[model samples]
Target: MAIDPRGTDLKRLLSEDQGGPVVMLNLLRFDDGGREMYDQYAEALSTTFLPRYGGEVIYAGEGSTALVAEAGQEWDAVLLVRYPSRSAFSSMVADPEYQQVTGLRTKALTEAVLQVTTPWE
Candidate 1:
């Protein structure tokens, strides 16, 4: 239900940092007409914010048939975004320009999961 990270969430993310890059796994469930809005946000992110913050979209795709999930667990879309570090990601989200377009993302999703992943050693 939470579309955006809260201040506490960002603080925790920073406090838990082990250093190095972080990949964010985003599972999205959209509202009606939400895809279009999300696309707009994505465009700005890919073209501007991501580059500014040393991040990139590793993978992004619509969800397909779920072979191993509960009946109501299928996501509408998924994205893997890699950031140079947790601080980079936190800073991006805090950017004033990014804040202007963040409403699009918030309005677009009914539910989402933004999980952090670190590569195995």
Candidate 2:
């Protein structure tokens, strides 16, 4: 049910960094009217914060029929975001300007999974 990462989460993310880019997998379950709010946050992220922090949205899409998950496990949306490094992502989230718009994201989701992925060697 956590919509955003906490300070400890960010610290752990950095401490576990293996070096190089990191791709985050986001699974979102929205509240009523949440999609619109999330869109606003996404716009600011793509237009400003992402570029400023060397990150990019690798893929983003609404969830479709789940062929392999449990009945209650389907997410409303999914996003794959790639950051140059763990520190870059941490920095972006800590930016004051980004903090201003982050509330939109917080208000938009009822539950979320923000998982970090490392590419296979």
The candidate maximizing lDDT is 1
Q: In candidate 2, what are the lDDT values of residues 1-120, reduced to their tens digit?
A: 678999999999999999999999999999999999999999999999999999999999999999999888999999999999999999999999999999999999999999999999
Off by over 4 Å in 1: none
Cα RMSD of predicted structure 2? 0.6
CA lDDT, every model vs. true structure:
0.98, 0.97
Write down the lDDT that model 1 would get.
0.98
* Least accurate 10 contiguous residues by lDDT in model 1: 1-10
- In candidate 1, clashing pairs total 0
- Model 1 over residues 40-72: C-alpha lDDT tens digits? 999999999999999999999999999999888
Model 2 — TM-score against the truth?
Answer: 0.98
TM-score of each: 0.98, 0.98
lDDT accuracy of residue 87 in candidate 1: 99
